[model samples]
Target chain A: MDMTTPLVEMREISIAFGGIKAVDHASVDLHAGEVVGLLGHNGAGKSTLIKILSGAYRADAGEIRIAGEPVAISSPRDAKRHGIETIYQTLALADNVDAAANIFLGRELLTAWGTLDDSAMEAETRKVMGRLNPHFRRFKEPVKALSGGQRQSVAIARAIYFNARVLIMDEPTAALGPAETKQVADLILELKKQGIGIFLISHDLHDVFDLADRVSVMKNGKVVGSAHVRDVTQDEVLGMIISGKCPPGAVAGPGALRS
Target chain B: MTESVPAPATPSQDAKSFADHLRAIEFDARMIGMIAALAVIWLGFNWLSGGAFLTPRNLWNLSVQTASVAVMACGMVLVIVTRNIDLSVGSMLGFVGMVTGLVQAQLLPGLLGFEHPATWLLSILAAVALGGLIGLFQGALIAYLAIPSFIVTLGGLLVWRGGAWWVTQGQTIAPMDSRFRPLGGGIEGAIGTSASWAIGLVICALIVAGIAFARRRRKRYGFALRPLWAEIVLAALACGTVVGAVAIANSYALPAGVARRLVEAKGGTWPEGGLTIGHGLAVPVLLALAVGVAMSFLARRLRFGRYVFSIGGNPEAAQLSGVNTRKVLMLVYGLMGMLVGIAACISTARLNAATNSAGQLDELYVIAAAVIGGTSLAGGVGTIAGAMLGALVMQSLQSGMVLIGVDTPLQNIVVGIVLVLAVWLDGLYRKRLG
Candidate 1:
């Protein structure tokens, strides 16, 4: 194990359900202060790979490393303990609980008497809201009363509240309006400044170009190539996703490091 | 051509706060509607009976009679809030009453040779414990085995009722020892009744004030609170109405000794104890109130309450959030059974007999009260106050219809219509909110 290794190194990970290989021989590295854009067509193993990282699925073969030391993650709790958090598309929030309660959902702060310390939870919620610079109040009642961006703020706050050092966000800005999207984008920048690595899974090339520091393209359950964001064009990435081969001047131009 | 930009508007800050104020009191619309319905019925009854219906004695009688079902309905509200129902409460009540009767009548004389408070306490404890155990068994089947609570508790309804019958050998157990009767049977003279009413009203006022202050403080501290003035005004109105009711009833009771003195003046027989407080106002009413208040606090002011709401709102989401949904479900059912036990104690005390059929069909009334009180059958929303109001409305219709000489069959039809209308109105409210 190298002390200065990247935060996450997934090597030769493979997962199969009843002999159908959903994810096969995939390897990727995500380092701190870097955004990894995972790109692939739908059902091409991008989500499966991300789920393995988030502990929503187990790999049949391969090793997952956190800071160069191999670790086993069998559940979402395990992932949280390893400082890895996932923000799913559904956002799995209890709609009746207010923003503060949602942010501290499973790990709510408790008073000396073991009751939910609502005041402290509110204070902490406010502090995190300040950090995100969200455009809403935490005490505006239930999450059902919140707008899209406000709900996203709550989801983000939950992950961060638990001190997630590696964030795997599944389409954070998918259904958001333009202003809401910009707010989330700003939140991502804030998180990046705090030196947390992000694995942003998306189908939008525009978001990838706007926010990714590095892009790893997956095709047929394998990482075809990985490169600096500046080294690839949207057209080149699209071509690789469609053809399983890189275009001219792309990171995998001619003979990029063979997998 | 450039896009013309309007002057940057200050962030629309007050709009949300203003909207919140408009919608804050909206949550209690069902409560208001139910109260209005009750008032309209009372006025109609008064008109039909030519003001006799509004007699203080009758009103006091109504209150006492409404208490038993009202208290049971409070617990039912919490049970429904957790997306569960206990159809076996009536059956549980019968069984518990049997336990109470057997303990106080059959077992106490044979074992202790004398009855004391402890004897009654033990009986009550045994009844509650039995109810709790039955609830726990039902909850386990529902929560752990993933069986439907409806089916489990429905089975429980038949099982407990049969158990009650078996325990009593299909006989009515009677004559609860006199020592344990005062808590559920005693009534006072006009002065004592008035004093009790005054004390009860003061306690009610203190409670209302505490709740209002806490709500206001929560809102002031940036937590959600309804409109402050509205809450205070509602509380004050409720207290005033109760006190006024008590005073008016006391005024009509013929001034205690005057009735007997007038009879003697007319050369007629004089009654003992100077007429005995105008129908004695039933001890079960106070007991019911005490039970209702305690249960309401449990449902509203505790973490257990929040858990019930959460599980009722969405069990799957609650589970994923690590809420131990099964345990919560179990606890709620257990609480419901214990409440049914309390109701059994009151009913047994009121009747002075523990018949095998003591609480027959009573669960229907309690459940009807909860549903008519705006508790969603799909769950996640209800209130003890609403349940009490519903029970009063139901009981009032039953009593007033009988008083006004309506046929029992016709009364049932009318009550059925009211229930349907209440449910339809609730559905409309939900649709509008949606």
Candidate 2:
């Protein structure tokens, strides 16, 4: 297979907070239209790696490339400018505000008089929701009143509305029930169909198998190995996680993971 | 081809009734409790005064006394609605009074050379404008500079008081323009005739009716609306009380030449009933009403008000939403400063002097009024009407206590207790809602 060019490639990304190395020379790459699962246990530097991409945290040393072109991403605003959007675990939704308001918050559509143009915003929200998940109908009620799946839909709508090309989801299904999780998975598929690459950070291996095209495992601030979902078994991935070495089941080669 | 549909759910129906029942119970409890408390207070005062509290003349005096603080409390309500306090209102009022006094007394005649013939009109205009400017300054600093309002306005209380002292050289500026004096000093027309008093009550009724109807229309149209019937009833009761007191005042007259002679004998101790209701109502009541209405509009209709609530409820969330939280904070404090300025003006005008000790301990009353009226100290829920009522209650206690010859120190203690009780009750009510 040709590893010709990736949509985004982070080369040896490292970040240290105070004296602790949160991420140490971790590398990740996503190809166009690919769902990449970043699987790691707690404190395995998975979130830090993705946050570096989303510009929530700046890498102490590394190069991150979008479309194979090197670029600087030092802030979330910078990430957005570079067409990278992150949906945090908290969803960052204002509960008291309606779905339309939640979607357009911080970047509201204003009228000629500089006041919020409610109709225009609501219309835009409806249009975006229809494009992503046509089943979502609760637009007028506050996000706090919305179901978990509906709230997730709104968060996805916000990211997509900003014309994000690379979406990074931090445990999107962490707080959701099974039904809500399914909806989020379907949303991931839908986004992939539209040619948007996704980096899904999750501890759920089942979810990785069901959704991701490629699975990259990180153990102790390092990428252990990456394999296509069809080529790697659950046991093999678990072995790599436990022993930090590629098992015989890995496709890349024997001894792919080394201590 | 017909599949038997499962029976429609009954649990949901039961829940709907349950929720309705709960809401009704909550509202009834609040209304009944408030009414009972009011009744107890009235009866207690009546008994203490040997039935003099219910006498027409004393009751009229209570109504008159309640009006000023009630009006000021209206503005205080909005200020607190945004989860802020205006501790400097008394000092600010003193300063405004000084300004009004200086201007109307022709200390600044060049500034008042205008088309308007009435010096009082120009003086009030200047005072209010100054008050608004002070508000803007305080708001800008609190909202933009990210200063705590408590510190900024505490500093303002001292600054303005000192400024007032400096302006009048720590002396009373007295013998204000006669036209201005009546705005805080009058009774009903034709030696206690009830006509003017009746007119005043009718106007109050009309205002209350207008507000209630407007609110009802909004609620009917599915806008976020307040409870209409409660408001209307409150307005009606308040208006009726005022009117009844005025009618009672009309039934009696102070002994002829008593008030004039008292004023002549002691320059400061003017006997009651010398001035009529029409002239006296304009300054304090009108000032308070205008401030209250403007603030209500700001809180309900303006983006700024919404931001205040959002910030108060959750500062982090508000910041994420791009609300300029710092700017909003400053602006709110500044606005409080300005309102205090207006209050100062009214207090000074009423006394017809910018006395050094004119508004001592008055801030406690206003703040207590706001708190008792349900302006949550924790922030994010309050109303102009509630604050007004709170002020009215305090003023009532003050007037009634004085009539019964209660010691001033004890009166303070009583009012302080009432404030604590009101807050405690509010806490319990909120807990029930939870």
Which 10-residue window in model 1 chain B sums to the lowest lDDT?
B1-10
Tell me the alpha-carbon RMSD of every candidate.
6.1, 7.9
Reference-based lDDT, residue A179, model 2: 69
Model 1 TM-score, all chains together:
0.80
Compute each candidate's TM-score over C-alphas.
0.80, 0.68
Tens digits of per-residue lDDT for model 2, B1-434 = 01112344556766565434535333444444555666677778899988988765665455555555665566566566555667776777767777777777755446555323677667777777777677777667656766776776788789877887888788778766665665563442123344447566666877787777666544554444446565667577668765654466565555456546544666755546563221222334544656666777666445666666656545665564456666677666556655655665566667777676666667778888777777777766666656766776787788878978989999989988888889998898877654
CA lDDT of B201 in candidate 2? Answer: 68
Per-residue lDDT of B353 in model 1: 84
- For candidate 2, lDDT tens digit of each residue in A1-259? 3567889999888889898888877777898789999887898788889988877678999899999899998766677778887787877776656777767655667657665555667778879988766766666556766766677778778888987889999899987877668878888998899889899988889998999998888777877778888888888888777667775544432223544
- Which DockQ-derived CAPRI band holds candidate 2? incorrect
